[model samples]
Target: MLKIQNLHKSYSTPQGPLPVLQGIDLNVARGSSLALMGESGSGKSTLLHLIAGLDQADSGSIQVAGQDLGQLSESQLAGWRRSGIGLIFQQFNLISSLSVADNLAFQARLAGRHDRHWQAELTQRLGLTQLLERYPEQLSGGQQQRVALGRALAARPALVLADEPTGSLDEASSNEVLQLLLELLDEQATTLLMVTHSPRVAARLQRRVTLSNGRLAPADGL
Candidate 1:
């Protein structure tokens, strides 16, 4: 569902250009999960941002779900960001003012893909049925992460992009959330591309790749 070839991205700095991703090449099959591992400042997040259409690549092609992201206009990319991909961040970026129910439905509603029945099932399966009316602050870290997961998958997006999803959680909570996420993905037909630094987390995925020195280290980059 995703293909990257010779992808390159750089940033403007006082020290001229600082390259983040250099000649990255990756391919992910549909309905499969991949773990992106790298050290701090290894450009893992930079590559993800490019794939998410939140940032543009300096040179290279990124084709996702058969659409060339580089060829998309800003408005088209914005629309794609809304419907084509599901994003789960480490911080769980839930709307502070919205209830759990509203937060789960927010992106799905915006994408015109909201399904009440599906959400009903999701909440039950996610153990979020009793917390529908609760606000973000009312929930624990695990609960909030579950809500974030639900919100991301509610739309049945073509691809799920998660950046350090379990980074903030304790090991046990992270394991629980990761297992829940994998089970949900198994039940659905979407693809997952997750960025995680933990080997335990990476091992749970179908495939793993690591970035080193602005490039995919061939040893583990697959």
Candidate 2:
């Protein structure tokens, strides 16, 4: 559902342009799960941003679900993002003022595709039913993450881009969240590309790709 060709992204440093991604090529088929593994500053998150159209690449092309992201205007990209891509961030990114239920349905409502039945199912599956009335600060880290996941999947997005989804949780919480994430994706047939530092998490995916110096390595056994 996603393809990147010779993608290059660089930042202008005081000295010169510092490259974060160099000639990166990747393809993720529909309804597949893939893990991107890399160390700190390895551009894993940057790659995710590029794929999600949150940031523009300096060169090359990104095609997601048959749409060339490079060809879309900013307004078009924003609309596509709301309708096409589901994003989960390490920070949870929940609005403090919004209740859990509101936050969960926020994006789906914005996309004008809110499905009450789907949202109800997601709430129960993600263990968020009881906390729907609570705000983000009222829940624990794991609970907040569950709400975030529920929000992302509420609209039945074609692709999900998660960056360090479990990085902020404890061991037990991480395991629980990861399992739920996989089960939810499987049940919905959602395509996922996750950037994670955990080998155990990466191993659960259909494929594991490592990034070193902004280039992708072959999918090897974790």
- C-alpha TM-score for every candidate: 0.97, 0.98
- Looking at model 2, residue 18 earns an lDDT score of 96
- Model 2: lDDT of residue 120: 95
Candidate 1 Cα misplacement greater than 4 A, ranges: 218-222
Give the number of colliding residue pairs in candidate 1.
Answer: 0
What tens digits encode model 1's per-residue C-alpha lDDT throughout 42-116? 998989999999999999999998999999999999999999999999999999999999999988998999999
Regions of model 2 farther than 4 Å from truth: 219-222
Q: List the residue pairs that clash in candidate 2.
A: none
* CA lDDT of every candidate: 0.93, 0.93
* Candidate 1: residue 64 lDDT (0-100): 96
